[model samples]
Target chain A: MSDLSPAALSPGGTIGILGGGQLGRMIALAAGPLGLDCHVFCPDPDSPAFRVAARHTVAEYTDTEALKAFAESVDVVTYEFENVPAETLELIAPHAPIRPGAKSLAVSQDRLSERRFLAEIGVPTAAHARVDGEDDIVAGLETTGAPAILKTRRFGYDGKGQTTVRDASDAERAFAAIGGQPAILEERIDFRIECSVVVARSEDGQAVVYDIAENRHENHILKISRVPADIEPRTAQEAAEIGIKTADALGHVGVVAVELFVVGSGDDERLIANEIAPRVHNSGHWTQDGTAASQFENHVRAVAGWPLVAPHRHFDVEMENLIGHDVDRWPDLVAEAGAHLHLYGKRDVRPGRKMGHVNRVRPRER
Target chain B: MSDLSPAALSPGGTIGILGGGQLGRMIALAAGPLGLDCHVFCPDPDSPAFRVAARHTVAEYTDTEALKAFAESVDVVTYEFENVPAETLELIAPHAPIRPGAKSLAVSQDRLSERRFLAEIGVPTAAHARVDGEDDIVAGLETTGAPAILKTRRFGYDGKGQTTVRDASDAERAFAAIGGQPAILEERIDFRIECSVVVARSEDGQAVVYDIAENRHENHILKISRVPADIEPRTAQEAAEIGIKTADALGHVGVVAVELFVVGSGDDERLIANEIAPRVHNSGHWTQDGTAASQFENHVRAVAGWPLVAPHRHFDVEMENLIGHDVDRWPDLVAEAGAHLHLYGKRDVRPGRKMGHVNRVRPRER
Candidate 1:
């Protein structure tokens, strides 16, 4: 992918987004100021991104005719999530260029491959082993021990498609919980906190990483994200370096987020890579109000082949997600001073669904 | 209009915009974050606002059927520009309430009426007289004197429909230039500087005014506006008070701009009202990047019956318009540090057409 010539997108060019969710809606919002038009292709007609996009095609990703028309209409293609099938990419690649490329997607789609890729690139990750069946699970438990997590190798998100294995007997139950899919057995390491580093890379290998964001999750769903993560300067630097290295190795042409866990304490504290999200992550939402260049805008710029601006954080920010019934407090939140509310325009608020997020910024001196 | 009860709009409610230009586009952009959808109604098929709006109606303003359909689709109605005909407002008013009401539009539409309204409200304005024809122009010049301006009483903007009268002999030519339309003759005051105050008012008479912006015009079109206008504190306060008074007098439910001229020197300095814009003004464009709450967002909140936030300036800002060929420098401008570019997405760049604007912000302490 790096050897391929990078074509710069003009202001009037259209960007095709694969998923029409909150992330795609935000990217479309940012693209408007840059004089770029957005065309969203999503299977759901009720997708929130359609409201803000210049054009949208409501069709399944597997619909070849719809995908062909969408690709031909856009100058560049990008996706909001990493679970897009490789076959869909293969179809779109013949018409329009897909940023972050297939290598990043392929590596991050499966948990086993992501862990192996990180280790191959000298990025430290949790101890894990690929599990195939009863024998593989028995062998994995013998090596990694009990109190490990049995996660399906593909299509897992927000703690779904995975379960904790307390002992040898629990392995079979965990496997059954995941519907007997291919899985990975990993030791659950005790860590101080969880944080993520979002980095943007251009086609020519130039990369810029945002400040670390400390995230707190409830029910495996992101609840709050605060920028200028509370970590030693050395740990922050190491996290950024790991993010850049991961993006560079994948030849990614858009934003990539690397989730990491801080292990140990004091001088011995170090970052351990936990997971890789080859697209915009929820943790980076704080950058919208905290920094001069937001992750979404930077991704648009990188994929558009424009020079990247150094991400500068001018204010301390805390972004809180409004999930499910939490959005019911919107009337009160709208009146809160210094709070910038961004509702996704979701019509239904099912339990555990992310409806929107609010960003609050305070001056650094304050 | 005040007797009509104010209804607060929910987050998902739709706002109907009367014109589809850069202002409408910006308002639509601001509405998205507040969880509001926008529907633009304009006659021009090439309208830039249509690209960002969720819905749009393309029909002449006189088309009552289209107007009724558009009005019924929206919860509240507002306009980008002030030239909308009174008849159009009458048609929409039966279905949806028009913010800023008909009084603001009626007064600001005709120069003679605006001057009279300002004077009646104790707001000092430039000396002027109504001109019905050549005889009126001659009689007006006898009192206002030479070196005065002859401008159409209605439908005049950006130096159009007006001419400069240098001497008595120029009266006939000036009247002919305006096509014998009813006009106003005003004495051109020697002013040290030009500035404007943008004030937003809610239905209940609560008002918030942005910082004064020093303006520079090229051929009567706004070229640049710098916030924290160079003016005495007393003059700035006076200007704000005048803006609030004007908005209150008209029972304006949205944003209103009052252009003023600074006269005298030292302690004798004072502000003289020059013109009134019953909608968002170009000079307030700086608020988009320089303040925590932009003028556009404030306008939306006011018209939506939401409480207004105090216009707080977080940074010193200079907003420069990219008119006509000036947009050609976008490639270079995009690379400039601390510069936030907002392109209007206009397809054609005719001379004097407002292509876009760029805002440069500097820290207040710096």
Candidate 2:
């Protein structure tokens, strides 16, 4: 049989990564065992991914020369985050194939584009309207209704660049609070719980959606993710479908994670797709020790054009992120039985910063 | 509780590893997620471990100046192989604490000393005699019985530096075959099967012995290791006891592997201790995917003065080593549903060289 394929990379092939945070660090870590090397390109000199990567290019994303050199040196290009500038992708496009491609990146970068794309795919999202200025806020509220959140259309994460619009009168101040940026207003849905589905898609359209993870956030940062989500089995299946649909729609070649709001409970439970992260995400971290192949490994496999590992989870897992000073408890965490600890090699622990995570695994009861 | 301990290292600590083969490479890989960095010291510039490590020192093992610098730079030191010279350890001892200490290294480096030490610990080994010169081979053969194998006392691995003797008549030829080195003659074991036990020991003397693994060899190199070895429960328990006893006797602070030859069958089955490896052995590689903490991770945890995870078996596993051109089968292996592939980043593929391994995991049967 022929051992060659169009997008398939041999063992020693190099993968170029755009960000150098924990997610990039983990993807790079996962690549090493697969005999794949990584060249991490990031502006920060002290990026965590640099510690484990075979190569690191310390240059701004906008620097075309550095981006070109980095792109040419690798077999394929992938990013850890969604905010990579379009110009950067344009420059790298001539050199290496970028997985999850430009369309997914562009759609996920802007809130308006993301919701519109979700709507176009027949996926259910919250009622939302565009707000370009103070005058548009009233019209946006008229469509979205009161008690909505006015969020910036671009460059927002961790609850930043957003504010609460209690009513029509509160729209002007909320719009001013967000620095008059292009924004979208959405009616706040009082969901029963928050959850996410992580799915990996191969170049041939084969996809593996991990078990939906019920999530809890503190200060708008994901604090914990538990597998075997409390949602009904039907709701879980529906959530996974949303993830696979989003991946197929984007023609994504790597992992895609969709954050959803479970609006009801038991037989009435319904999922509302809220956000799409086109990369290996924190909510899926439980797979590292709970399943056969983690999201990181599947992402690497997908981008390298290898077959995806079906998510065969062996244990019920609860992944807790050690944010900020919470990481100082590593001594106790590492000593705990059944706790699989993964600490990003970040020396400083600032408040709200993700220092590491611990996956607590137990024998599957179901 | 206070986070300070004598041998314990903090999250950002560096571990200085001696030897840079696949074992060292895996140890470095395991350290990454624990927030620890590694500095690999090996003479070969093309060492496989260098790619995954944060720092690499390419220098001769006997270079005291280089060894001293490497030891002083890291919180602790450990070796991936037993052949680390005595003088090298003496120099490094003044700078950093070495795991699987000098005593364990000394015992494992020489075949006679290893057997003698095992005997003193109430372990069973084959009857053997030493031969320092060609003339002594006859006496050694007579003591060990006619058909025997003469193995060098030092620097031997993977069936290298040894020869087999048919009887006393073939003594001179067999002695000459091993370069007339200080050797030991052992009665050829006509055994039912070969197996191994891997045990990890912490600084506090806590030990966790894994289930015995039955091993198969081709061309004297490990070809496969299957966990839940087809041995009686009593025999398996006895094998684990030998592993833990050996580790505790030497005050070993990392992983220890004991290879054993099983003789007879059913009620008469018994174990004959053969060789001891002071580092993680190939027989334990199955743990990477079949268990919560891999042998490499457990070894890192032990050497780092962290707590050890009890051997918690999750799957019945068969780990096959892909030697030389066997790695050319990566395309097919990666596509296999239950196979977890790990390729050592070795660019060359000379015959008998280990290129990678695949762990085939299945649900536990017994």
Estimated TM-score per prediction? 0.97, 0.99
Cα lDDT, model 1, residue B219: 90
Model 1 off-target regions past 4 Å?
A: A1-6, B1-6
- Model 1 scores a TM of 0.97
- Candidate achieving the largest lDDT: 2
Model 1 chain A: worst 10 consecutive residues (lDDT sum)? A1-10
In TM-score terms, which candidate is top?
A: 2
For model 1, residues B1-366, the per-residue Cα lDDT tens digits are 122233888778999999999999999988888889999999999788888878899999999899999999999999998899989999999899899899999999999999999999999988888999888877888777788999998989989998999888888998999899999999888898899999999998889999999999999999999978888888998999999999999999989999999988679898889889999989999998888788999999888888777888988999999999999888777778899989988998899999999999888753
Cα miss at B59, model 2 (Å)? 1.2
The number of the candidate with the highest DockQ is 2
Model 2 interface root-mean-square deviation: 2.1
